[model samples]
Target chain A: MRSTRVTRRKLLRLGALALGSTALAACAALPTGPAKPTGEPAKTAAETTGLGSQPGPTTAPGGVPVKITFMMWAWSPENEKFERDRIELFNNSQTKVVVEPLIMPYEDMWTKLDVLVASGQAPDSVWYDYAAYKLIAKGQFLDLKPYVDNAAAMLDDSIYDQGFWKPAKMLGGDSPYALPIGGEGMNLFYNRDLFDASSEPYPTDDLTWDEYRNVAIRLTKEEGGKVVQFGTSLAWLQSWWAWVMLLWSRGVGIVDSHFSPTQCTLDTPEAIEALQFLQDLIYKDKVAPDPVQASVLSEQGGDFASGKVATMVDGGWDVVSFRSIDRFQWDIALLPKGPKGRISPFWIGGPMISKQSRNPDAAWEWTKWTAEEDGQAMIAKSGQQVTWLRKAREIAPEGAVPEHYSKRFETLNDLAPADVWSERWNEILDKVWNPEFDRFWKGEITAAELVKAIAPETTKMLQGA
Target chain B: MGRLARREALECYLFISLAVAGFLIFQAGPIGVSAFLSLTNSELVGTPAWVGLRNYSAMLHDPLFWQSLKVTVTYAVVAVPLGLALSLLVALLMNQNVRGISVFRTVYYLPSVISGVAVAVLWRWILNPEFGILNLLLGYLRIDGPNWLLDRQWALPSLILMSLWGIGGSMMIYLAGLQGIPTHLYEAVEIDGGGMWDKFAHVTIPMISPVVFFNLVTGIIWTFQEFTRVYVMTQGGPSNATLFYGLYLYRNAFRYFQMGYASALAWVLLLIILAMTLMLFRTSQLWVYYEGSVEKA
Candidate 1:
């Protein structure tokens, strides 16, 4: 019996040794090579497309001009053309670098970016949005702080708003990843024609939420048993920013006024009241269209632009697209005040250098140039965006602002920093909050119920962050 | 074997090498890698940690996984049979000796040829609650149409209805099957004083049972893997009612970067599909009519 037991033990020992060795072999085989940035981004792009190397201007002053790709989502042909023109301008103004624009549709941007980053062939510089940064921040984006620090004297640090730059650190660490390009503050854009048709006076800048609601309900018109115009429409329904702004106007948010998120304060009475107000606008008052109704009408431009909705909570960035609305006389005003104050949370996005970028120096130069006075001047001239640089805003080309709407920029004074700047903003807002809020939109749930359903999960996410 | 025979065998293998290479590289390799990944914790952005069966076990407890499974199973159950019936009905209609039958077939087949995005966009416009032509037409009939894509109760059904629009591919297959049926069989039925129902039940059904089986299996597989429409149309929204397994897997794999978990989900899906296919094959012996086979149900 003893001899048999010894033999069995030996067999077990051998099996264990073999298994260990096999595991060791697997561990060794599992891609230990560090993901090094490729020699040139353009070369990587060339390889991907099965094209021969693209020619560069040999007469460039700098040795072997750094060829880098700039990635952005071109949602429309007009946007693509505009970006292409600007890239050409950048190329003409530079000698040390040649920027190659890699424009893709907005829908494919995240998927394509993931593929690129995973394959270690990310563009040198890619358009970065704060909400999307956290998902892609894992060893993909370079810490731009060192570059910014080195070029501190040259860079106009004051050009970018402190609120705009504060959230850059929330991209996972106390290091700036992306610099501000352009930003937009929220505004209440109302149709004068709609107001005139109803003989309702135009809403004042300091109009309270109660007054705003009353006016909106009064302006809402139904003729021949069909709604000719809705009272109001709100953009960014799925974005937490909208709710955050509303809560801020009441001096609260998902988080407290710490300017950085820590926990879910959404269950508070004030937050619930704010959410209830928005909910009432859709269901009780029927002033604004429900999400489904809005989606249908918004397809024909937007509720505001389609003239189906009398008022819209829009942004300064909308001015570019809003200019195309020739059917109505529209103007912008400050967001309606809550019991506490009026607050319009600012949103900013811009170019960021990939950590995998081989040409960080050249990329930084390009990024810096993008934020420079000249670039800002061009952006301002386009009248589609709010320039970061104060100087550029001052030098905005003649007729950039509509002659009557010259004081539109005055709404900038009402801008407030968002309370939360979580990297998981995209997931929390789109995945968690919006889906639950959708139930509320469908009238399947009340405001309190919506908050009750969402708060715990949101709190967990915030705590995790 | 003779030298000539051996040479012929070699040529046959040489001709088939490209397909074998493609299968190994694209299909088999990824499948093998996914199996290995299922045992690990791979986020795709960091070093993978070996944690055997943890991902699989974790999914067992995940409410979303269970919800997605229910959604996917419901979608497959409803869509496969409905799609098969619609395609078969369309095929029967197209089989008639009518003028412009080919033109009708081509027109019916157009929706299948259109991209998923275009189809989704078209459907979005058609199903819009307020201004949609569907609702407008329904209003004319005094029927208040429900919000098709927005209402959770109606969303999945709407998708199933939209899926039926692209039944042309299967219709073409069924049409071919119908055309291939021997005329003598129908003539035999007629001579025996078989009515239309008798002929259809005895001759048509048996003759086309193989095609039906094929469509059933393929439809089940395809419906289970329906992602593009769900992603483009609803994005698994209206309170996660349309959160199909494919969309859930995609979220984990790409959006959330939980590649390892996604791989585990893939394996579970593979097993589920395999079991289903085997079950169908087992049942097929009872109903499927093979003309030349010695074994008959």
Candidate 2:
């Protein structure tokens, strides 16, 4: 008995020793860095990655040319290749300035950029589509108004539409901070086979919300007491963009007319009606799959991509993915109009000059070149997003688009790019409003209850800044 | 104190220098930094401004902090005991002299070896309301399954169930404890007219009590820190039903850029975990049976 007791105590001591060592190992394995900012330590521009690099030509004074670091959020192999190719093209085309690419995933982009700007190591130029106001508020971006005025003959404002250029003026003051390069507008993509199978006429450009809902219900298929197919799915419901578009279609914006952070207009009758209609589509009408039901098709492809959903509202960026769908015939149309009129949200991707750039002239030259027809044409050929420039839109590479794809451009005519690029916009939408809206989606609250519960808190967050 | 002993001590110090440096730099340094940061207001980019105790006061008034605390406690309370019990049961089953027992042990341990993200993604597919294999099996009995990840009422419980699946590590620990028990004790129990249940209760339970305590403490700590599955599967959603404290801290730090508040949250978590562990150690003397120690009372 004494020996057994001694053995058990020894085992206990051994276990403690083992656990202590295991914990030490775990501590050693932890990544060395501050949390939150998902970026490596800032490095000089001379470091070339294994992917590729080209040294700048000796053109400037003292036989050393100005070298500028150009970074953007490009993660996919194809996107990285495209960005690298564009860098090489730009570097080869000019001798006065050299551009190097610093690519990273989209999620890491803002965090890295914020750190860079704060540490006074910001790249000379960057391409970003969100959080414009945060940079503008910090005075981190160069005002391109003077550059644009000086190069008006070269820029030629008539080449771009009003909606395409509208988002560029997101600077707190009345100066353009970014020049538009590529963008897309929301469009309704429908499976022709599903409509034919349901003996329903194909949807047209001017279809109203009611007509769209009715078509969805008619196209929904159920057998053996279980729904095998859904009529429609929202392309990106998790984003505030869907809600914003829905509200816009009803002649209201999510924020106040001034896009003030301290106020939200989502409590209006039109907004409520729009939200309620979306809710009814899921719970009341059952035309669309709920969140869980939708996740099943996520692995293979999303609902519309996998042919489980007959129609979905998506942007032009989805064209590349949808084009690979050999399983069915699909095409695009305008989003359904609300009682007021037809309206869709537009997203603009562009390049902005950093305020801390040593070579501001070189940066402006690069930014200006990206908006030109040649740069826009490269984007058009990629089929990732529609080029906003008119000539690029008209002369997009032939194989890049499907037939009748010009309708995507036509839908951009009355595009309403909600002034949602303000600082605290993402913070409020993600932290304050999203969880409440999620509750509303789960049927725990009505649309009225949701907006009422979320509005004051959202206002508080907006005012916090 | 002798020359040989001094030489041996020098070798020990030399060998352990790397580990000691790592601990100070990676673990202790970050902990001290976070403690200091918890007293200040800093976004990731800006100069930290001293705001002593403000972050703590903010946490007191924050409803989400309380909700996340409740959720994490609920998860730990449910998952820790359930996981420990399931692990012990599996260990007991695997201890039997059955054919291909090693194969069974390996197969059971496979899930623990898989990455958390892969496991979460696999479980998400299994828990899908309409087309998942779980619901498909449930349908055979004419039972309509609830949406596992989507339903507010079922989401946390579903995550708890997922936690129960990766108990192979604990099972192996219990197996080691079970194997270490002397055969003479069981024989003595048998000689005293003890049945299997009596032997298990009097001998097996006492012998494995320390292992049980170890598993319980570790399981509780792990459950309190659960993040990856909740993030990959539900993202603390369907109305923040699965908002584990770790996930909430991550959101505060990364998503909201509230590094100061997140540091406060981290320190609070540390204190809570430390308190619980210390309390467990203090209380462990009452229930955990040890052999060679002097008897109290």
Candidate 3:
């Protein structure tokens, strides 16, 4: 036998080999494909208590509760707790089903859901917004119509607010895919202190476009050759969805049809005028900050809450952040009426059962429950969001900081679903619409030029050309 | 074969088997999968249908794809050379024997060690038009600084400028190479009636040509894959001025769910980098000099 000598070179090589082998083994041991669902049935409350009327866990025939996952994106700690509490309530309300909450960050929710879906480990139900139309087009959502038909008493159409229900139905096309839980409507948020300081009357619900602009100009305060306080801010104008509200209020739809759009109507004179109005607020009037300035203001502190701006057109959900503003008195009002009408852009979202759910019946029960009085009551009581159920909105907990917080529900009649309801919504916004609007905001291109440039491309995209 | 030689070869195989297996499984496997995926219409869910070169052909008509490629290539073109020059200069400065030099070196390299996202967030504030330090300094000089990330004309340039913050990484490598140069070579240059400039040009530069070459190649590759900073900061916004190729690929894969298109984009990026590296190697003979090696024709 030959004697082996240990050398530095051999030792280094052996070490590397060991490291490499360990890595390879680890990689080999890594799980592949979808993970098996970890929901082993839990014992039923009914088996122990034998009381059907009492609030207890319901179970399947074998005395095991069917487990389902509910995925939701929470914007804040309060929102997360609200969702967790709702899930806990539902879990305790029945003996047949158990719901596991999967809370994700709002920004990452869609991307994470896509990954979960692709891996065959998707949650049984997902809280979705207008973006859910893409999933509906792909037939990824279970048709809630059948579930609703079967659950007439629990999930009746008459009980829902048509403003949200209509869009929810439109989102699903021929069949309803989601049950309307709650929605956010765009409104005018004004700092009452600034209004008083400027000797301007508080904005009324009926303020027209011209009146709104004049008010903004009047309220604007300039000192030492610098605009100390803007009369109004176009902070939300950066989003295509937000600016499109101006167009909608002006009776200028981006597309000819909302349901099945073919031609892009954004090149119309009305649309250009609407967009130009916003552009003028920044350049011509200088009463509002540009996108860059708005971002800077936001970075420093809350733009409106910090008393930098007199008024802003924002969503009802902003109340959550505004509630923390103890320095100034703020209130919500209807958005300034455009040339056409007072059409407010409303973003409605709700729970959608995934088509691939293992226990779809259990998922449907969860979905149905969210639309029922209990779920809407939870939304109303939280004051973090507005309930879409007509009955629930009537009983909403009042005296929230905004004082006129219930005014959000009043705009339901004038609500238009935000964003173009197309499966290619994100693609159109990211590729064509946003780029042109960004240039327009930058003063690189006029509103007319921006609209014209994007119209043809947007039409082509909508047509799926 | 002789018994000793066979034994040695077997020992070498034993040492390398693990590495070869790892490379084959992880790197090579993904490369192959992506190549195949590039030829399909995978939405990352459901069955991916075979689309042949449809995704690549789609690139021909995709304006954003071209814009992203232009942005990435332009970034590489400007950032790589500038970074090399700056890092090399810093490396030369740090190579000097001075008091508290290690502290300076550590301070200079600190930014490079910071998390990319954290650095990006910090840069976002530093470049803000209103409250940013850069704009504040410009204000002091009575010059109105352009909105760095918000202005289309300035966004890409701002990112390129931000790239310099991490030059400490390459600077350290150059510093190592600078220190490794034999002091006798500098003395020889001096003995031959050469001035400081001559000593640097002939001795120092030639001695560190390999390090320069290494930095040049890596700098190009890294600049071409610039995504994290742009993603965290601008998100390829302000009219898509800072849309790097990597960011676009990421948008396609994760945002748009066009995995096949993203896979195609990845392959194209890989090929671009490969061609660039190969071109550098082919041209290196003219400038890159090695010590005690046969001169290439």
Per-residue alpha-carbon lDDT of candidate 3 for residues B170-220, written as tens digits (9 for 90 to 100): 999999999999999888888899998998899889999999999998888
**Most accurate candidate by lDDT:** 3
Best to worst by TM-score, what's the order? 1, 3, 2
Could you tell me the lDDT of residue A247 within candidate 1? 80
What lDDT tens digits, residue by residue, belong to model 3 across residues A81-103? Answer: 98999999888887778899999
lDDT score of residue B3 within candidate 2: 100
Kindly provide the TM-score of model 3 when superposed on the true structure, using C-alpha atoms.
0.87
Tell me the lDDT of model 3 at B231: 83
Instruction: Show pairs that collide, candidate 3.
Output: A56-A94, A57-A94, A57-A95, A58-A94, A58-A95, A58-A96, A59-A95, A59-A96
Name the runs in model 2 displaced over 4 angstroms.
Answer: A1-81, A84-105, A108-126, A131-136, A139-154, A160-162, A221-230, A235-239, A257-259, A296-300, A352-374, A395-400, B1-8, B289-297
Candidate 2, A137-182: lDDT as tens digits: 5566767766665544334545665566666766534577787777
Q: How many angstroms is residue B139 displaced in model 2 relative to the true structure, after the best TM-score fit?
A: 3.4
Better of 1 and 2 by TM-score: 1
Interface RMSD of each: 6.9, 8.0, 6.0
* Candidate whose DockQ is highest: 1
lDDT value, candidate 2, whole model: 0.76
Q: Tell me the spans in candidate 1 whose CA falls farther than 4 Å from its real position.
A: A1-62, A153-163, A172-174, A224-226, A256-260, A395-408, A414-431
